[model samples]
Target: MEKPLMIALDFPDLDQVRQFLAQFEQTDQLTVKIGMELFYHYGPAVVTTIKQADCDIFLDLKLFDIPHTVEKAMEQLGALGVDYVTVHTLGGFQMLQAAKKGLSDGAKRAGLPKPHLLGVTELTSISEQVLKEQQNCRLDMNNQVVSLAKLAKDSGCDGVITSALELSDLVKSVGTDFEYVVPGIRMHQDAAGDQNRVATPKDARKDGASAIVVGRPITQSNDPEHTYQRYLKSWTLK
Candidate 1:
């Protein structure tokens, strides 16, 4: 599969998604992400719509639940034929295994390729202080990310979704073959917004990230296509 630059479609409704994607009508083979906002609003049917448009979907539901619940949910999500999906590594070994099993079973039933199961290590919005104070995590940020990434790999996940800041350490700990789908990507001039740990596309590439998820920098730009092309160039040129 091609290394993807996933554009997070963080719109509130289907029409806004349509409007956003319309800008890329001439550009085929896009890898787009459908996060909770649009997924909850439109359900699985949005996947079909995006498929029809010839775009690959990375369904970013960030599933975190009991093993049974996550398994059943993965079953349903896998059947949608999305290219990727995410689950929280914090869910533990049994849950990750169950999720993987469900994805396989669902894909087998539907005769579709199983989506890449990405385990989320931590949200970019979270800080080391926040993690220690609120979640009672004892390790520093890099150690915590590496630890969760190791658990994800051991429990059958295909890769991990982590901040670009953690990519180098994660690769060192988990090995280079492990997929690192990084979020919190922003250009130097862009605002950080809610994300605390951010990196430029060039930085993510240097850190050996497999892919990067970019949100407002592209979607909210005055020239979305130009910004998208810039990001693509940043990854492709070096």
Candidate 2:
């Protein structure tokens, strides 16, 4: 599988997304993530529009629900022909298995390939202190992430969306074939924003991340196309 550098289209609306993507040449293809903020506002039509532009989509809603509900939702999303979709590992083993089945069934029905089902371990904005104090999680942050990765893999997920800070440890625990789709990647000079645990693109690649999802550093840059190319180069050559 290609280790794609995914640009998170975190814009509030489709217009902003269009304006930002307009910087790239029409023939240039990109792997993009459409998260809740934009998707919720425009629904699946946003995904269709991006698909029409020949971009691979990673729908990052991080679905967490009852097993049947999540399964049904995955079935619907699979028909969208997205390259990847996220499900919260906290949904447990049964839900994970059901989601996998739903995606496969949906893809078969739609005559498209199954999308990669990525489990979300934990949000990058969460810190050790927050985990222990607010979430009442007793294990350390790394342990908690590894534990989730194990569950995700054992339940049949193809990969996990984790912070780059934990990618190396997760790979050690789950083995390399279990894809590490890392987010919270910041450039050396960029602000971390709400994400507490962040890594640079080169560091993420060095840590053995299968792919990295970048948002603000590229999307909010003064020159989005230039910044995106810089990130892509770092992932490819570093």
Candidate 3:
């Protein structure tokens, strides 16, 4: 329960979000991720609703652009008081630094602590084939993920969103001082769906992931709260 667990709330609207969250008790201290869809549909207002629910927010837009533009955008996003925000690791050092500075500056203006800046490495949907043929990246998937993670660590990112398969290598390569928020998590009974490199919560924990994101396994379950609690139990098991 103490370990960070982020549930991906990929719903497109606030009403559905409320309905889903209402299933949980009021005392629950949930940490949820708001990806591009909800944010695009409802804008900053979505963050307000999440905050009102007494939940920690992971604003996972995966911002990627020139340094100046990203910096400015992060400034606005940071003011929403989210616990974490993401940038594309491929954006390079200057952009990452700009994101951190912009986030800290905006947070200060709003009298809130700066949200952690997470760099998104290779997405879980990407495989070796996709990396080599589609993106045309010379480095293999694991090497590229580790490389981007190291760059992110040096460039002021507090953590990275990498798959659990690369989590151990990330810890070994980048050191434990950086956070590793792994996604593409699926239990044994869950379908892989579009994910290419998914792992169980136990695998992620064993590999030294600082946090983990679970979407459909819980979100799409017949009983979301029960599924979430069950996963949380497994996540903490010795």
The local lDDT score (0 to 100) that residue 43 gets in candidate 1 is 96
In candidate 2, stretches whose alpha carbon ends up further than 4 angstroms from where it belongs are 26-28
| Ranking, lDDT, top scorer first | 3, 2, 1
| Candidate 3 per-residue lDDT over residues 102-174, each given as its tens digit | 9998999999999999999999999999999999999999999999999999999999999999988888989
Estimate the overall C-alpha local distance difference test score of candidate 1: 0.91
Candidate 3: Cα lDDT at 217: 88
The per-residue C-alpha lDDT of model 3 at residue 23 equals 91
lDDT of 2 by residue, 1-238 (tens): 2898999998998889888888888514789999999889999999988887788899999999999999999999998899999999999999999999999998888999999999999899999999999999989999999999999999999999999988888988899988899899988888989999999889998999999999989998999989988988888894
The local distance difference test score of each candidate is 0.91, 0.91, 0.91
Q: What CA RMSD would you report for each candidate? A: 1.0, 1.1, 1.0
TM-score of 3: 0.98
Indicate the worst ten consecutive residues by lDDT in candidate 2: 20-29
Each candidate structure's TM-score, on Cα atoms with residue i matched to residue i, is 0.98, 0.97, 0.98
